[model samples]
Target: MASSLNGKVALITGAASGIGRATAVKLSKLGCALALTDVVEAGLSETAELCYTEKVIVAQLDVSNAEQCDLVVKETVEYFKRLDHVFNCAGINPTAYPILELPEGYFDKLVAVNLKGTYNVTRSTLSHLKEHADCSFVNVSSILGQRPSKEMAAYCATKYAIIGFSKSMALELGPKGIRVNIVAPGFIDTPTNASVKAGPEAVERSAQSVSLGRLGQAEEVANAVAFLMGDEAKYINGSVVEINGGLAY
Candidate 1:
């Protein structure tokens, strides 16, 4: 039996690990061909090997660069023939500290990879997606996008920007048959969160806030991304789906 996403092609950034890696694997099993990009070439290729279904192709992509964004999209189109889905999952969270205590450069770097990077990837894929008709862009925002925390100001800014960008794209591209959406995950336990887990009180506080009383898995977020990208979401767009186990509330 053919899956709903059969024959589709997808490009996922930050594909080396965490939600990105999980999304790539899920989409592949659902019958989508994959193009994987990340600054971590070794990890990206390793992820590709582990995918086990249509093996994802690894490409060194630094989404902070518009040229690399353009190249990645162009290469995916050349390889897969048509672009059907894109998941902008690449992001960074620097040291957790008060806004004033953080360096201006830290905010700059965070915005470059998180906000501007999504802009770069989504904008580059726009033309091809329009040509393909009925496609989707799923951006990985954070629960911090909707709420503020004392120690994570800059990361929050970019994630919040993703919701704004997704809404605007839905308005701009809806008529063009391109669906744009956002997935804002909260307290996800990825490698980056390992540091938080090491801090006993910090991890405890983080987990206590979630309704589920624990951290989220990367696969959980990937499931939402896959749903938004698949045909089941054909009627949905311009929506911000929160997968934080009610942590934001």
Candidate 2:
């Protein structure tokens, strides 16, 4: 069945690739108009072309920039006349390195993109979302957020922060009828993990770690985001729907 999101408007960050791109396509299939933003202009255009509808607007945006976040949200609201759902998926995953061996600036950069970036977009669109009766927000976290990984301390920290931020937003927005939720994906087969997947042994080890005996796909995560944004998840605020193929728990 099609979701109640039909004809609704959604803004998605990092919509150029991976789970973000998949979510854009999925939501479009449900008859949602999309405002897709990413730093890669060409990739954003490619994603826009693949969407189910021509109501897609592509913008090159750096989610870490507060001004860009505000501008994009303003433009989307102006164009769409209302904002219904937001998917904050723009983030960076640095090379896995132990805390002691991590570069000086790497931690700050990841936090800026992964944590503060989510905050920036949410803050920019919170008021506009309030104007709608059935609005929602879905933030993309990761399995590392739920369980710490040995060499991914910085990435884990940012993902963990996302859950906390999402829960707090859910609490604050619930009374206003704007639901907030999160999705934590694990070992998704996407370009973002091209280097990791290049190693045959790494892929084998990751697959074995999951009970499902394989990695999750971007479409799987996208489906969860769509559910959280639709009426089927009307009472699912403050929830963290993990899509890790049983890798974590």
Candidate 3:
């Protein structure tokens, strides 16, 4: 379409903080109304307030819950009467224990919130998204999705699954004029990684690993997402836009 999002509506999960919140604000500035959801109500409300559009709606959503995903999608479509974009930014990042010492349910929990949550939101929005001419679905993955890390098998598995799932959906939905893509981000200074970035040495070590000698910012990832969702990338689909600062690994 190569047009703007002046009258479009976007549904963003994990909109409480980080890339999700940044994406919401970016879309709002581009003239898209927002349906922002997250498990954390406080952060989500703040995001909604920061949005420049008057058509913003905030909802509490635990993306792991499929039923809740359906409800939230229904509410969004009903409130806006149309949904043109989706950002699946709801995910968890935690260092998994070594295979031998891995907790019983740790893997399953990660699967539920990261992989399954992305699937839940995508499937819920498919019905309405198909009806739109220039619809887009963007899922968030991680650089770890392509490059493995020690003691992070569970997290890596979910991210890899998202890339695969999103690409598959892109293939399935492309003929229908609905674009599906993924954003694989490297080390970013988001709240989700507050623990990992707690120590200066840890932060410096991470920066040293990137060719740019610095970690990425949430808005950098959000910018890629906004571009992919907009008409500028109308011909792009089944693609993975990596936001890592040239990580050596």
Candidate 4:
């Protein structure tokens, strides 16, 4: 267990599964209490149970809903008495379509969940985080944010916007001892994208494109996230830590 996070309280969004669940478990192992939220209630409860912390709270949250984000944040602070860390890990899977063929509604949905969702959670937590020292926030972006793929213009746009948003927030909050950073993962094997990795041939081809010749794991990404939220990464604000298994692109 890491003493640096002992007795701290962390609010994790998208805690139902994948990177979010892995991160919640990681923090709990480090002696951090947790407030886990996701739209999937059953999975959220399962995550809460897997956490080995003294205290854990679960909420069914849709990050795309601003009111829900605010309410959840308030509930977390009230339950834990303080919030020292936040992980905006809630997001929907990307829909790939060429720019010319993409639906406007899908683009709006992507922006709502990927970009504005981050904003709502961050805004609601800022006041609470500002009061504490060594507070940190980690927003999950994707390798797609930097490297574009065909038929993913809308998804890429949303991801790219998140990086800009995180950098701006880092600048605004760094002065107050609040650090903001991003973890850009590539081809991470998570439940959210199980279909994409369903076939062995698809998985093999994906692996070959990475210098490491493998897909990244959610736990691997969570490890990087844990570091960013700890005091050891105090000087790493406004940085993007890539966990893409050395993508060939």
Candidate 5:
């Protein structure tokens, strides 16, 4: 609550639920005005309500669409006057299949939403970030980016690309006072993870595989993100912080 993010304006994509929803509330507590976006309008509003920030606004858009990305950024800035931070968290999991079994269409959509979606958000916001002396961005990646797993080749590839893109862009933007970083989370409990955890056999299997005895909470990741985007992490650019409870090992 004492962090310097107070009064800063932020735009977060995929803000309807999960980590995005958690982050919206976290940032609001830090006194940042927010603009939340998601393909789901109703969920976006739900997140806005939790934020409880009078300055909060919501928009519905598919981040993978460049034009929608452009419009969302433009409109968010127009509403907030200036953009100080952004969290590119809009993403989708790849089809759980072997490489040869995956379809080209599925791969394309996954990349568009996961890898290219991150690119689209930052590409659309770069100009605004450059204009602000203290612009900061944290792109959501996954511990999968650090490694791989069977039946998760496509998802791992996309997450790995996000880390690469964040580092490369960080170097380019650092001189301009814009910071870029990646937050790589491990398996976290969510609607998706809940289904995976439902069956007793699968839950037992995952518990054995994960380093942590239990799945992670979205707030845990949101806290780490807060630090990276805050003034405390001004020198932490071009780095990928893993929030996976040592799961990658």
Candidate 6:
């Protein structure tokens, strides 16, 4: 498995923390050259340090900006000389609230980051991916995208849209050997959930809510992503791999 990814190039967004950070580390260990980006400059540098290799480049990027997206993709390709995989892990989840009470700017912000951001990165990388063999894309969505929650209307909408967008891309790009897939993770124990896990009872409560009786780890999702990006999953495209420990079921 490691030999297969060695020397290949991957571009990962949201590489500063959470799933993105975990994925970047995992890929680096497999000997893949990495172009890592996130809006959080410090965290991105921290992640780059953890990679601890000259094969990695860290960039501060906001996926929502089309021009920035193009620049990052172009620069990564120029640096690596080839692009094999893209992991769109940059996203935001605002505090849950009912649609009526949701802040006026909140929905727009979420849409811009979660939905448009994914599109921007994918658009910028599509042509490059098409030129490469065995290329693939893995987008990060959430369980809320598949199963809606009472106060997560905006989040759900964006995630749901990701599934649709990924499927459409899978169809359009499959012929060119460019695969696209989505990962819907649930209750991942990342910094984004620090507030939810603050109390002593928080972990237990979260565990009980899932059928697997535990919270998912960022590395666990990274495992799924790694598989999807590799030759083993070459036959898998336009599919949504739910790494939620059967939470939605």
TM-score of candidate 2 versus the correct structure, residues matched by position: 0.96
Q: What is the lDDT of residue 157 in candidate 3?
A: 89
Against the true structure, whose lDDT is highest?
Answer: 2
- How many clashes in candidate 6? 0
Q: Return the lDDT, model 2, position 220.
A: 93
Comparing candidate 4 with candidate 6, which one achieves the higher TM-score?
Answer: 4
| Candidate with the larger TM-score of 2 and 6 | 2
Write candidate 6's Cα lDDT for 125-219 as tens digits: 88887444888999988888888788889989999999999999999888888899999988888888743547648777877879898888999
Q: Model 5: which residue pairs collide?
A: none
Ten contiguous residues minimizing lDDT sum, candidate 1: 191-200
Worst 10 residues of 6 by lDDT: 193-202
Instruction: Give lDDT tens digits, candidate 4, residues 72-153.
Output: 9999999988999999998877866877889989989899999999999998888898544889999989988988888988
lDDT of 2 by residue, 1-249 (tens): 756999999999999999999999999999999999998878998999999999999899998899999998899999999889999999996578977999879988999999999999999999898544889999989888998878889999999999999999998888888999999888888887733657878788888988899878889999999999999888999999989887745
Clashing pairs in 2: none
Prediction 1 global C-alpha lDDT: 0.84
lDDT per residue for candidate 1 within 48-107, as digits (tens), equals 877857545679999999998998889888887888888998888546878679898888
Which of the predicted structures, 1 or 2, would earn the higher TM-score when compared with the native?
2
TM-score of 4: 0.96
- Cα lDDT of candidate 3 equals 0.89
Model 4 segments beyond 4 Å from truth? 194-197
